[model samples]
Target: MAKTACDHDVLIVGAGISGIGMAAHLEMMCPGRDYAILEARENLGGTWDLFRYPGIRSDSDMHTLGFVFEPWRHEKSIADGPSILEYLNRIVDERGIRQKISLGTKVVSANWHSDRACWELVVDKGGSRQTITANWLYLGTGYYDYDDPYDAGFDFSAFQGQVVHPQFWPDDLDYTGKNVVVVGSGATAVTLVPSMADKAASVTMLQRTPTWMFSRPAKDALANFLRRILPEETAYKITRWKNVFMQDKSFKTARNKPEKVKQFLHKKIQKALGDHYDPASFTPPYDPWDQRLCLVPDNDLFEAMKRGKAQVVTAHIDSFDATGVKLKDGRHLPADIIVTATGLRLAVAGKITVSQDGTPVDFAQRFYYKGCMFSNLPNLAVVFGYLNASWTLRADINSEYVCKVLNHMDAVGANVAMPYLADDHGLEEEDLFDFSSGYIQRGKHLMPKSATTLPWRLNQDYRVDKKALAEAPIDDGIMRFDHVDQRTQQQLEAAE
Candidate 1:
């Protein structure tokens, strides 16, 4: 077999927020380091480019959603998908990151070549396979498999009508005047169902469990005020902090007193929809934030139902029929198009194959070092977004910390960077996340601690992570390094 070529200081996987943010920092702070962003799709924006369903928007505002250096200046707090995509593309163009990205290149697997003291990455771009090596691996794959959405689309196929997974929405599929049935109760489901209701003949939303739905005007008025006067970055700061506090306060209420959060949300619902809204039907049986809270656009969904445009059907879908869904309650709801707004497919370490030398690390037995780094893995870090806040907030801080560690490495003339190893499960006491979503459930054991109440714990609070990451030492207890020769044994063994 031909030997794989090994070169470069850093190799980043996936050109999403984390990848882009980390790349920006690495090039700026770690001068002379060679890095490349490899992407599977022939586009820059990962999630935005992948999902094109109607009414798609960021679940959180763009202020915190944007990179720290490049703040989003849009008037609206919560930006739609197109605008978000445009913003990312603008950055890629302005920074000339487009060329640094190997478009259409998908990372199949990355193996630690102990002999080289770096990682050997295999990628498939188009039909050609390429091998590249780097001293450090930054994974920003965003913990999702876009293809899996439709892989679970078989139940949806039972319907005689059109079936589409929001992630893989067919450009040719049309929903005009056709009755639609949307499944799932998360952000994707709510956003797609009501927006389609505007044009479809009718819409029926099926849910396995209920989610706390909060109503907010898509465009926040105060943000509009900030946009007119302050600089875009300043406006972004204002809006970002505003959302940080708002979401924090809102989520705190739910975690503290479920009844109070429900009451507050119900009051808003009553005021927004008035007679058209019925709390009895809309109110979720479980507490708010049990999973992820559902965000609605100015009660636009409720208005659709009030205007005789749609209806919400709460039931467990046992299967699908030729023209409708068969509920566990023994009732059939008809439709012309079926969209499974299901949850995501969970992945750890952005699906990078972590190994000791060439031996695959068993994720089932492994523990998270922090939310960002993995145990037993050296010279590697994964950037994961906040399930609670706009992803960019966490990503910005994560990249900053990563750069800080890299800087420390350069100062010490170190060859490897790794998580601060810890003994025991080392997991925090209270649950960081209790989302009942399947993805969360599947990988809950391997995830890092939430430590929402502690400083060491990743709070997803930008203020907190910013300070914590700022203090991490390259040789902190979680990490250790040796001179080049010391790493050669592992590298040579893997090569053999």
Candidate 2:
């Protein structure tokens, strides 16, 4: 077997949690594998580094969100953006992954060459374009669009006040002593309403439709207690598993008994808001887990409402008047600053133009293989995290699985490994993501196709994925492996 000439064995896009996690797995599982992380931004940390909005924090708990290799020592389980960024920076530095990262280098396009069994990547760095080749391409780029956020098509030109989006929050903008109105009722809106309420004269969350809101303490009492009695690694592992189990069970329960979960959530909200609680404002039209539940840490949003510092207005925006937003119900909300915390615009393969032997690869037309690789896509794995649980949980398992595939390829003297999807394959195509979140619904067309069974769809359950991804054989009958020299021979055999 002969190895192809390439710049690196593996080229990972995005220096965020997914990319960093993949590199770490490669180091531990497949030592001496040459790899480089290409980050488009000038800095790393991905979403954490990108979002600097008020009250920017993780909706998910840190015990499960943190990498399995590293233990989260933060007292706050739902950590702030800066704290999460610090955690990521520490991992890169400690693991010597920082040196391998190429900041400001963005992968614009990637083409797979079957003849050489390698990927040619076109990257842009400071307006200069360059090409790099690698035996394997791993996309750790997150699901959302970095350049463009979801546009709700709100006409803010008529409004006299300043309008901003949370995706590209201005660092110098100050809303102190000014009335602020945040649009939409997603996680971002919930987070911003309470955070801005502290300094703003009045903060109002304007929503078209209500979203399921749940409140919990920012700090994990059991996790803190476990840390006091146990070693850091052991305590972290126990807490992580406990959170994973709870998350899975909660999601399942919500799907199974929506009414029960809805009542439980409403009770918590009522307890926090007291007299301020409005069933119409807190209750969503759909079931609990239809979309992600908005996490209100320490009852911050409810506290703000109770204190008269913040309010939740459920109405459709007819238009933005000079004074403020004009509601369809004939109400005008005065606002000095408007923050559009609408939602994210989902993207696939980091919006990179992917091609196979000069033929454009449309992910939506292809099937997702094992939640990592795509059908007929060789030597490539894209990390798409679990929507129901922590993003890192899926990332961790996907990284390990990719490493296993790489090692298996090496053992078999194979240069290319592609999941073959035949025309007559009986796999039924299903929605890639089950969530009815606005972003998911809007971006469904751009996502890869999913089947009804395992290894053909992206499993949202981390517990099931953990076992399957770990124990599943790398050389599954569906995946075709061949050496560089055998490519032509295999193609000829397939043609016949």
Candidate 3:
């Protein structure tokens, strides 16, 4: 298990924010490590490149969403898709990470050889199968299934109108001057309704249940003021911390004082919608932050409703007629186009088949270790973002933590590092994600198990994780590190 036996020191899947961020961290932390990024799509930006639906923008502020290494100079903190893509592109180009990216290369399966202490990846490139080996496998592939979104089981067979899913939005589809009906009440639906309202003859957001919505200006005034007064990186750091603090406080308040938070949110929405605000359509069955709240920048959605361009209907779908949707309440809504803003289908490890030796690894059975690695898994890390805050917040910490682990292995002259758990560890299993969102609930079985204790659970709190992941000692009692020669000698002795 020599280092020369592997093609590269690291193989990063998906050339999106997470992959690019990991590469940047490696360049800064582990200078000489050889790494390659494999992206299935031809483009580099993962989510930004995949989604082309109109009015697509970041629900979170850019200061927190953008990488800590890079400063977001854009005027709008809540930027659109193209702007975000530009920011990512700048990062890769400036960091010299662009050259290491392999476009149109898909990693189909990864098998870890314990004896060799490396990962053998079978990939599909240009419809041809090829094998690549690496010492470490870092999956930056997002949680959602790229090939398919969550199916709401809508029957549109008899509908003559065009139906489209936001995941695979057609570039040529036009809904101008046509009645459009968007299904679901999550972020996607909330974003689509007002975006389509400008040109559509009528835009209706059809939801089975309402989602909590909050409105704010897209541009951050304080951030802009600070940027003018201070250096770019300095301002970015300050703004980043400020937003992070506010986000944590808001989330905690929502959890601790749901009723008070709900009233505050209701008041905000009422101010925006005014005469158009209806409790039935605006109020969700759950409390704030129970599911991620929908962000409406500058009250755009409410403005559209006030202008009579967009409307919200709280009802269940009965079926689809030739012209439109029929409500379960015996009401018919006419539409020429139906956009299924339905949620995403969650997938673990980018749907890649992961195995140890020749046996497949079921993530659901393994305990999550430090929100990055899994128990009993060696030299592998996956980035899953925070549910309550900006995704990059988690990605940044995870990338830095993985770099620390790699450096620790080098310092100790260990070829393999794994979090080892005994068969009867007596750890109680808890839900990995605490969200009641449909996507989380539906995909719980595919996710790794979480324990009640630290280092064994996938923590959602950024403040807690930042301190633990950054400053914690690498050689904890649970993590086993072994040199190749030592491992071989142990194997020989065991065989004897």
Candidate 4:
């Protein structure tokens, strides 16, 4: 049986970056209104808390990832997981948000109560159930959960060596003097394999396909130094804007022209590893960011390989035995530790079981309003970041807009709002993303569409978000709200 324990003004579903940002904004904007964040995990920092693999760091710089209110004091733009987690914890503590956080409470479902115009949420924790009735619900559950990595038909238990999935890396597992095979070619694999190779006798990154490796400065020293002399805000704005532009331009080049991307990526790879690294394995067949692009930490992964600490083997793995992995190409790499850095299942709403009054909407059936909100759901705002920059950059804008929405709703005495799309084109689930990953390709029919490039296509341009959220009128015609007429109000008051 469902249990009713508490009620609040707003019930936030995740305690991650977006969830924290929402709590901070709500408390800052509406001072005393009751609100609470329900976290499924026992800790905070959703993605950072989950992935413990070495070289696990932010792909985007800190300047953009950081909240506008809090200036990241560190000189390093690309921060490690621990540092990022510390910053988030500090934000929560400084804001006195710990009380607002409800740990070990997992929200199973949020059912809308039309009569009360609020949500009756069922939460499970410590083998008991509690129901929270909230006027508003904010979702911060990330796109992926490392705790339960969905099986892609690859049997992992049969592997003989110490199997360490990045989702849950055991600290006690010793890889020293052991042959380790790291599966997958994404950033996690790139980051962990090189670092693991330092201790492991030999490291191999197994891949079913090719990947694009782009060189990046180890740390932006100049960007750091500028923060000291220049105003903190100025330095942040400069670095943030500059990085966004550079990243966009680089991505655009790959999309608009294949030849240029090929030449530049190949040239850099060749220069970094000299003649030892094979160009074939390094060369990506698809365009950059087609699947997820690999970011190199000052070309360290290749350097480790050239130095004979690591190697990249491109092949499909058939199965795993107690001793090692058997490749489809009739090769066996005996390993003591196997790290499956395989990709994750792409989910938009963090598996919260989204529905409306016991009527569940098929994810494939609904059309996207803004990459940020689902059409036809009033007062329900979704958080989805740009595919280009860090997830937080776009999320920051989304949080700000949500605040605007909240304030507007209070002023108008309207508790419901949903951003509706004018033209669905009958195809939101078309093959929008050109990636070939199992998650992307399989879920394409269910994901949002992007027919035109920027602005309308769920693009990740930060400037575009600034214009849309900050500059545009909050009560734009795209979203509708209901207000009682003065005659109806007077009649109700007289009757009362």
- Expressed as tens digits, the lDDT of each residue in 165-245 for candidate 2 is 998999999899999999999999999999999899999999989999899999999999999999999999999999999
Candidate 3 TM-score, true structure as reference: 0.97
**Candidate 2: clashing pairs of residues:** none
What TM-score would every model get versus the actual structure? 0.90, 0.97, 0.97, 0.90
Tens digit of lDDT per residue, candidate 3, span 1-496? 2353578989999999899999999999989899999999999999999999998899999999999889999999999999999999988989899999999999999999887778999999999999999989999999999998889888899999899999899999988899999998999888999999999999999999999999899999999999999999999999999999999999999999999999999999999989998989889889899899999999999999999999999998999999999998999999999999889999999999999998999999999999999999999999999999999998899999888888888887887889999999999878778889999999998999999989998888999999998777888898898866635655786899
- Runs in model 1 deviating more than 4 A are 1-6, 150-158, 328-330, 420-432, 445-460, 472-474, 486-496
Residue 115 accuracy (lDDT) in model 4: 40
**CA error at residue 41 for candidate 1, angstroms:** 1.0
lDDT by residue for model 1 (359-418), tens: 986655544444566556777777777777678877777677667766677777776665
Cα lDDT tens digits, model 4, 369-470, are 555666666556566666667788767777777777777877777766666666644543434555666666655665655535322356556767677667
Error of 4 at 119 (Å): 1.4
Model 3 CA lDDT for position 248: 96
Q: What TM-score would you give candidate 2 relative to the actual structure?
A: 0.97
Q: At residue 231, give the lDDT of candidate 4.
A: 96
Off by over 4 Å in 4: 1-6, 156-158, 420-434, 445-457, 483-496
Which sections of candidate 3 miss by over 4 Å?
A: 1-4, 485-496
Instruction: Count backbone overlaps in model 2.
Output: 0
